[model samples]
Target: PLAAREASRVGAHRDAAGHYEVALRYSDALPMEGQAALHEGHAFECHLIGRIDAAMEAQGEARRLWQALGDRLKEGDSLRCLSRFAYLVGDRAAADRFGVQAVELLETAPDSAELAMAYSNLSQLAMLAERLDETLSLGAKAVGLAERLNRPDILCHALNNVGAAGQWLDFAKGRRDLARSLGIALAGNFQEHAARAFTNCACVEMNRLNLNEAEAFLDRGIAYCVENDLATWRDYMRGVQAQLLLRRGLWNEAATIAHDVVDDEATTALVRYPSLVALARLRIRRGDPSAGPVLDEMKRFLDKGMELQRLAPYAAVMAELAWLGQGDRAEALRLIDLAESRSPTRAVVGELATWRQFLSPDSDPGEIDGMAEPHRLLLAGDWRGAAAFWARIDAPFERALALLQGDEAAQREALDIFEGLGARPVAQHVRGLMRQSGVSHIARGPRQATRTNLAGLTQRQMEVLQLIERGFSNKKIAAHLTISPKTVDHHVSAVLEKLEAVSRGEATAAARASGLL
Candidate 1:
């Protein structure tokens, strides 16, 4: 037990689990309480190492032992562990049942850390289930109790749940709470809590479209997880990273990371969720035939829980795929209805609304307050505005989508961008639209190598290179492109890097040499 504790203290989770297993082998010599403690310790280590089955079995044993010994507090602690394990394994019903039982059992005990944790557990479950009001109430109780007890870990746990959920209603207040939780975890050297804090912080930034901030948090979180041997959190953070890359228009890198995480057999559903979303969205855009199977696999996650985060993304993906003139539009509409009814956060509503726009192009979505910027622009039928925003953020795919909402000239430009990105699925759809609209003399898209661009320059970057070749300054390019100089600067830097050049002159030379001019 001492060895296990020491190993866990140093972040050697696998070693801790092994030590706990050895201790448990001889635990029969100990009293009931000692045996239960061993089981609980082993379960925690197993949980950290992503051994859900072993964690559940050990926690169950601990729960039974505590129940037999008439220790309600210990039993409740075990139940909370079981609840967490169940949730990680995508058994939402079982998780909810275990959490409720845990809270009920702990309520009968005196004020303690265990009871606070029970409240936090239920709070987390409520948040994931999108019961925001219940989430806040339970989280408040947990936070209050944890504060009074001076339990930093419990406080961090409660704040994380409440803060993330609170963002749906109030972004600033939620961010403050999340920041506070992260501060506490860092100060206390709570490695697991810190990893979670980093993950949640990244998630919040990503939700608000603060791509730079999100990337910073992801970098720190992934590094911390690697240092601490937190494979599960590492994988979850990696999945989120893939999503961020997808949003940033780094599709090939995003697809690679997503596929790596999703294809790994040991990944839990929780870790797989975001990566699967990235993969499905990417494949759908590229018109990959395997997209259907990927989307179907994502759908199976809903059988575990109908959380807004899950439902909204799934609905948006399905809606877009359906709008591409495939799949069942009716089913996609049904999902949109369900997501809007559950938790209509502006981000969710905006995403669903943007996709829903295509399903019924004539139906104006009107104006929505606090809608995300790109969605707001799209909803207002300002394709240029939307495209400019995506360009500033370096999201070429979304910019292309935005351009598709414009006239023949804009649509032709959109087709060029899609072809440049190797988005054949959407490119074909655009070609069909052009044929219908009687736009003649369409240029054949870039060859396979050109579409995949040997220099790895995006369409926007290619345009920036052409302007550079004309000896246009960043300021001039920004004015010509209707974007900010800062954005132009960013594109210039990316172009220079991709061409492996030290100056604009060298970049132009490299572009000419590679026939990208």
Candidate 2:
């Protein structure tokens, strides 16, 4: 039954629910103990897919059915599931009370896995309630209990929760703990566990400036959630990924990702809209010229966020946009000063400080400490670090912007770096700029994409994408490749449509995502 329920998580949600409904029917037809067990599984599947009201209904029926049958263990399981549901919906106080009763009722039961579920729920509740001190005090005990019983899911949750709660830990110590948690999560085959660990690792690595690794890990995490059909977290990770891209300087791509994420059905925008503001800030930063609509959209978003939830992050964004677009130095100062009045966590305080320094360059360091390791790598003239950071963030424009700023020899070097990483569009743009700068063949190193794994590309299509990536317009490409400009136009549309791109910037990103460039 666990295996079947877990299977439904992979594809066709309604199909999965149908299977559970059938399972529930059979359980009702079976003996007392069988009926008790079946309802537990049914309620679990209900909760997994966000049918919270249905879940609570099923669980209530399970409790009544189990109590009537004199099934103490099944009754306890239903109560624990209720506690999980309550905790999920932000009822930490009731969750803790129900959870303790669950453990007490199950003391003589042999279901170690079920027992671990309750513990995991308790651990998560503690984390969400900001009982970090209590979490640390109780976390090791939970780990010991889970390990002694050999419950992998409980162990995974504990390890990940420890890392989440450890955000307040000292930097060096936090990194070591998060890295260890990531290793354990990767070792586990559970998709949810892997997603949790990878996302946690992305956060730590972002703080440490390991941009390349952060991007890679986040991709793995987001992909895992998508594949696992974890819709709620899939939406949450979308916000995280967009923020990384915006920070890396891929404004349009960031906006596109933000566009999909902000509409995800399962999440509220308390965390999500701040991400939109970041993208809006980027549109403003790149001097997009046609950003008037987006700015108004952002202001409306901020206003809505303020009404829905009083989040400090949204307020920080008001400052960010002021700094990015209006150049209202005094206004920016006033906004940040106002932000300090709210409870400034690391994200608010750190980003508020960093964005200001990034723009002014001459602004006082204030207490930012330093850029994330990835940002530092890009800033410190490390080609490999810059490549890795930009790739993780998938920020092709930023990578190109830096390449454009480089001297001739440096441009060639940057070109080689992008080319090597399959950044075809960016490398093409660089080559076009180099030609305009009048330094085409005067440089060294291989810009040739060298026939590697063409993967899914047709020979003619590959030729066209390569040319377009190299910054050749339809006329130049048609002239060089002996095709009509009309044919070149036709081929470009084919490539963009096939790549699922909505714009040129998006096309470059799609190439990167597909490993085509």
Candidate 3:
């Protein structure tokens, strides 16, 4: 047992698990209390190493032993562990039952870490199940108890759950709580809790469209995980990174990350779900037939749980596919209605509402605070407002979606963006919409060019390419060309795409090699 403690203390979780197993083999020689404690320790070690079954078995043994010893406090704590293990395995019903039982048992016990953990676990479950009011209520109880008990681990755990849940309902309070949780975990060297804090912070920031801040958290969290061999957390953060990349219009890089996670057989569902969503969304945007298999696979995950985290993204894509006349409209609406029934905060509901509008334009998406600015504007029939907001954020895809509802000129601009982003289905849909509106002289896109010469650069694109080659900034290029900065951005993007280059320098090099410069 001492050896196991030392191993865990050093962050050697696999070694710690092995040492705990060795200690458990001779547990018959110890008292009942000692034996139960060893089992609990072994269970935690196993969990850290991603051995869910082993963790559950060990924790069950501990629970039985505590019950036999008439130790309700320890038994309740063991049950809490079992609840978490069940949730990780996608047995939500079993998780809820165990968590409730644990909380009931602990409620009669004295103020303790065991009881605090029970509250925290129940709160976390409530949050994941989209019971926002219950989550905050229970989370507050747990945090208050943990603070009074002066238990950093319990406090950090409670804070993370509450903070993440709070972001949906109260953005400012959520950020403060998450910041506090992160600080306490870091100061105490609680590596796992710290990693979780980093992941949650990044997720919230990404959803809020604060990409730079999200990237910073991901970088630090990934480094910490790598240093500590936290494979589970590392993979989970990588999934968030993939989603972040997708939101930033870097589909190629996003696809690479998402595909890697989806292809790895060893990944846990918690880590795989987000990556699957990212990949499926990307494939849908590109009009790939392969998106069918990806979405089909996602259906299996949806069967596991109906958490907003899972339901929102899947439904959003299905809503888009339905809008494109390639999916079941009724089913998409059903899913969106179900997600809305969860009473999600503004950001999530706002997204669902946007999709709802696409499918059923007359449906009301009631006023929601904290909705992403662009989506709120879009839902309110302020297409120009939404497009301007998306442009300010540099989110071209969403900007295009907003512009698609505008006048003919705006629709043409939207088509240009979709084409540039390689969103073939959306671009084609935009073209169809234009034709239906009796718009004429629609572009057929740029013509193909030979390997030599300017590689099919338009006069404007060639000018942008030249400025890029000369190390001119976008602002400087815009000034020289006497065009709006937005126009300059479009031309710069076109030049890079035409040259098949990933960066300004590479675009210039490709242009020079093709004798276009």
Of the candidates shown, which would achieve the greatest lDDT relative to the real structure? Answer: 1
Which segments of model 2 are wrong by more than 4 Å?
1-3, 6-15, 25-27, 30-36, 46-119, 128-131, 170-176, 179-188, 266-312, 321-348, 353-517
| Candidate 1: count of backbone clashes, pairs at least 3 residues apart or interchain | 0
Model 1 ranges with Cα > 4 A deviation = 364-367, 446-517
Candidate 1 lDDT over 83-151, as tens digits, reads 999999889999999999998888887898999999999999998877889989999999999999999
Over 4 Å off, model 3: 21-35, 445-517
**Cα lDDT listed for each candidate:** 0.85, 0.60, 0.82
| Backbone clashes in model 3, listed as residue pairs | none
Query: Cα deviation in Å at residue 447, candidate 2?
Result: 37
Among the numbered candidates, top TM-score falls to 1
Prediction RMSDs, each to the true structure = 9.9, 10.9, 9.7
List the lowest-lDDT window of 10 residues for candidate 3: 445-454
Clashes of 2: 7
Clashing pairs in 2: 208-373, 209-372, 209-373, 209-374, 422-517, 428-469, 428-470
Candidate 3 lDDT, 291-359, residue by residue in tens: 787798778877877778888888998998998889999999999988887766556778888988888
Worst 10 residues of 1 by lDDT: 443-452
Clashing pairs in 1: none
In TM-score terms, candidate 3 sits at 0.82
